[model samples]
Target: RTLLSARAPVTLISTSGDPPLHIAAERPSAAATLATLIDAGAPLAMRDGRRQTALHIAARAGNSVAVATLLGARCDPELRDRWHRTALHWAVVNGQLGAATLLVAAGATVNGVPMPIKKHLKKTSLPLEAPLHSAARLNPASGAQMIELLLRAKADPNLRDQFGQTAMQVAQGAGWSPAQLSLAWEQQYVHGLDYLRAGSNHSR
Candidate 1:
């Protein structure tokens, strides 16, 4: 705060190439600091060495407060990192339910958008899959809640990835058979559709 008050550059890069806002975002309790940096004119869209904005870092860390702070500041929720993953993707993959919910509410796309993959450059390059695909890869018993949340956000279960596999197929490949996964979520599925319908009606 003192440095900021004295006009310390909020955009200063660390040795590892993270800006001050990006660094502050990694701290769960640093929402206030993040606001201060934003007020001090930190670039909301600035990317670090990882080519991620502060929003991506916060969502990956499961920092709901930080996610809210950035979202409130109108950060582009759909901004993609080097891997073409949005903050919503990070939240789902990391099992950060709260952050994922917030991102969804803020209008991140629930469907998979085509993202070019450079297979030769990065071994971790993900298939062109939506956040639900990441959720499907998680342990079904543990990941049911995430799938529910995504469903509430109207994520299409039948949406296919670059490999022509739907999220259900991905989950099945991960050892969660359709019957097993469906049984786990059967009761909640209707409720999710009801909620989604309510939201759509309200929006209309």
Candidate 2:
């Protein structure tokens, strides 16, 4: 009201070019400002300048409250950002089990392909990366834990990224070691469809 009454310019500031309404909606008391974003017709799945949505950030932040707000506001849990990562994908990559659990229970697809990210790799237009790829980059403990969460949600252990790399293959390449990837491979052997058996390099 004060900013409006003073005719002050409304500004949406985000370090990552995040949408202002989206940012507000992810806050502790975001409920206070949701009506405005709703009325203004904020883009439910629209990415900010950086191709990230508020739901994506909320998941990474492990903010269950904000996640519930977004879901209740009718935000699509399956919505993907530029990287093709839904809220659930980000939650898993950020080592947020609770947030990932909420999104998965809300019906986010377990088999949905996760988006990959490279913080400092040579930049390119490639988008074949996924949250699983990102998770595999973490230390063994966190990376392994993320795999467990995704698998529990029914994420396809046999899922191949844009590069045709399964989670097990990617983790192994990222130095997860054969021992760490064993569980993931076993789960795949159990849940993988016939399609998985047909893929090259799929045999355990």
Highest-TM-score candidate: 1
lDDT for model 2, on a 0 to 1 scale?
0.65
Question: For residues 1-204, could you state the per-residue lDDT of candidate 1 as single tens digits?
Answer: 998778778888889888999888889777788888988889999998778999999999989999999999899998888777889999999988899999999998877566454552364555778888899888876577888888877888766677766666677678886566775456645443344345446546
Residue lDDT tens for model 2, 85-189: 678877877787778777877888766553344531334454455556556666777777776666676665655666777766667667766566665545634
TM-score of 2: 0.67
Residue 96 in candidate 2 has what lDDT? 79
Each prediction's TM-score against the native?
A: 0.84, 0.67
Query: Which consecutive 10 residues in model 1 have the weakest lDDT in total?
Result: 191-200
What are the RMSD figures for all models against the true structure? 7.6, 5.5
Model 2 bad stretches (over 4 Å): 1-18, 25-43, 113-130, 184-204
Error of 1 at 16 (Å): 1.4
Candidate 1, residue 114: lDDT = 65
- Pairs in steric clash, model 1: none
For residue 190, give model 2's deviation from the true position in Å: 5.1
